[model samples]
Target: MFKLLLFCFLIGITVGIGLLTTFLYANTSIVNQVFLRDKYSKLQCIWLLVFLTGCSLLLYYTFSSQALYYSLIFMNPSLEPLQFWDALWVVGITDFVVKFYFMGLKCLILLVPSVMMSHKCKGFWYMCLEEISQYYCTLVSTPVWFRYLIDYGAQTSRAEWHFGILLALLYLIIKLFFVFGQWKTSADVLRLFFTQPSYGMAATKRQCSEAEDICAICQAEFTKPIVLVCQHIFCEECICLWFNREKTCPLCRTVISSHNHKYKDGATSLQLRLF
Candidate 1:
């Protein structure tokens, strides 16, 4: 039961982090756009690998001493010990690679902030040494927390377990709300464009003229183009992808809206949604 709870906690943390990153990436800023474009954006994949590796390690530690070996021998009376050793070697090497990758990511995350700060200091060497020391200390310190969590679980304190579960559930609820808002916005946008009888499936050349001859996203000739409220045009998929991240025109950075321009109190600015 404790092991099950531990796994649940880890899964919750993974999902919470993923949702947070997705929400942040959905921003219309240049930074987020670049991040989306980059092939190295694989936080979800990394988290999944880490989760699987951790579970394997945990199970290995729990049963490896005698229990696991005896069980394997009893289950397969004719199986050769040499074959077991061969399989273990393969699994061990894969586990080491996953662990190494995770450690590298952790080190990179810690190092980047310190390196960014080092440029502002005159004592460059001292700053570099300090940053290096800080990173090492942090790397070492993480195991202490893991040890504490493991020890706490062994003690089976209900209060701590309950609190952790509550926090994770809260994060999941917030993630659900974010997802709902995103889906609603997308549905509304699509309905506004596709429901037009005259435009129907494709925009006329006159409408297409509002955008450039080429799609900015794919760098190809405009195909199935959609004109944004800002008069900037892009391929239907390309612009939708951009809008999913941010509610703004990519070229001019004008806020996107389906409402026709309106006049009220002499204000001509596009009215942003409260959400």
Candidate 2:
């Protein structure tokens, strides 16, 4: 009866966490879609991730032996303590590692190009890793205590408590550092967008064709127009906002750069003075 109740409780917790993860994943997908407008198929990826994560957790607490057998095929850990919590412990650890480690690896792959992954990918990975770690820690702490309660009818040992606390603290520290870095990088990128003048601004003095004066981005008159290296022009603010989500110009699909591209802001100061 005790084992059954414990199992039910664990299942409930797993289901609840799964639901929360799904909710968060959906919210993130929606936000990205609104802001990015189909630049990438991130929603599909998130859906896959959420599905895999929930499946991992479900397999861990329930029918984890098959997964463990395949996952640890070469390791050959002894399973003699099956009647005890050994199987559960192995399942929990394996599940946590398989799911979270791969997710972390994906995030690392995303980061290889730039730390500015602080954009959207960073937060997604952080939330995912945090969830995985939370589940792992709970699994690590709960089973031993529950086993003690069931077997000896006593509380867990002081050593177990200390170990659990230390593990939790360590995980907390790592999560905090990661979250801080992500937020800091995101803030820096945002600051860059706000501080720098747009490449389009250099073209404000140019004569507008009946169509050229209108900004494609905002569908308004270019108030402080900037020109891309590709010679496409837009309102400075509009282009800057667009560039935050995508590096390419809205019209020509030319990749805009923060530096070194020639801009045609109508005329130079020398030309103005000469005129």
Candidate 3:
């Protein structure tokens, strides 16, 4: 009966979180705009507060639950059922809290530094972190027998933690190598956009006429327009903004350049599935 109740509670929590996440994702654009704007309605502010509170609670509960479960498994390899109070005692007195604290600290270490970095490098670093975390989750989600093997090995020696630290260090080194390459590419794209005459050339009267004297991006008359290789014309500012997030012409979808653009606004999703 206890197990059944616990399972039902987990299911209910999962369903509720999932529904909330779906709603937020569906209105992601509106949420973003509301948060970014200097002035927003009172309701929007309330909703934003609710969103942040939900995220904080979710993170807290997830890490706490994971730590409790892992500590239980480490203590009782056979996974014996326990009374609710017994489980709570194990969670409080064991290494669970320490592990949970470190997990949260590690996330902050990864996120705070990236947030402080320049816009050009922030997205790349975030992407690298996301990849590393996805790989970690894949390892964590391996078969139960594999996890047991890991646990057994960990119990035998302290080398497992050292090995994990070394592995993470090596991965960071490799990712840093790629980061430099990406930074160079982004710099070159910026230089080309600003320095190249072809990219910023003024649209002639004939070109403007051919484009119906309008910039398709802003849905208004052309202003300091530029023509692309695909013959699509747009306001230089408008196109520059578009190119920051995309690599193709907005209208024809033709490849604008071989170089990739940095993420727009240095913004990235904070959902790191470390479990």
Candidate 4:
């Protein structure tokens, strides 16, 4: 009865946490919009604090569970049965807490400066957070092949550790190559945005007459209108702002250019497929 009750309690906590996270994520756009428009708000500050606290709690839980699982698997054979509280105290405090501290430190390094900088840097911190979240999720939900490799390594003798380490290093090297490729692609896109007028050509009178006179982005009369490949016309300044956050034609969703980086929303995807 006690075990069943404990399980039920855990499930309830998990569901509640999931719901809270979803709600916070749903409101992120509103928070960003408010921050950009108004500069600051007391309620938005509280919401951000709550969201960050929730993230920290989730990180703690993940690290604690991982530490406990590994500790159980690798407990000294000669050591008597591990006491739950003792193991939790020793492993959780030493290993999990240290790991969580470093993770939090990384986040602060990425975020603190952006917050302290000009209001124009609003999207920068959000993009950094998204990248960090993507990396965290990828680490926690490793590929099946990598899991199998880790399991084999865990079960092997000390002599096999070197071989496993070598394999892990090789895997990291290959992954780094892909990451480099992505970085290169991003650099090209950045160059295109700066050095070239890839947004579009100036809209001719004929083009302007055919398309809407008002820029879709700013919802105002077009100034220095540029017609994109999709035949949609927008103000150069308005389209530039839109392209900063999106690479698609606002009307038709056509990709802006071949140099456009692979993006979902404004955040660049760091996800890689092992298969």
> Cα deviation in Å at residue 137, candidate 1?
30
Clashes of each: 1, 6, 0, 0
After aligning candidate 1 to the native by TM-score, how far in Å is the CA of 81 from where it should be? 36
- Which residue pairs show backbone clashes in model 2? 200-225, 200-226, 200-227, 201-226, 202-265, 203-265
Error in Å for residue 272 of model 1: 33
Q: Once superposed on the true structure, which residue ranges of model 1 sit more than 4 Å away at CA?
A: 1-202, 209-212, 257-275
Q: Which segments of model 4 are wrong by more than 4 Å? A: 1-46, 57-163, 189-198, 201-213, 216-219, 223-232, 237-256, 261-275
TM-score of 4: 0.44
lDDT of 4 by residue, 54-87 (tens): 6546654754543433332333212123333333
Task: Output the better candidate (3/4) by TM-score.
Answer: 4
| Pairs of residues clashing in candidate 1 | 26-245
Model 3 misplacement above 4 A: 1-16, 19-27, 30-46, 57-212, 240-246, 250-254, 261-275
Please report how far candidate 3 places residue 50 from its true position, in Å.
5.3
Q: After superposition, how far is residue 80 of candidate 2 from its true place, in Å?
A: 32
Per-residue lDDT of candidate 1, residues 15-60 (tens digit): 4354334323322221232233323245643454355446545644
TM-score of 2: 0.36
Best by lDDT: 4
lDDT of 2 by residue, 116-205 (tens): 433323323433443334333433433333333233312457776566566646655665575565565445444443454344436745
Model 3 residue 74 distance off true place after TM-score fit, in angstroms:
20
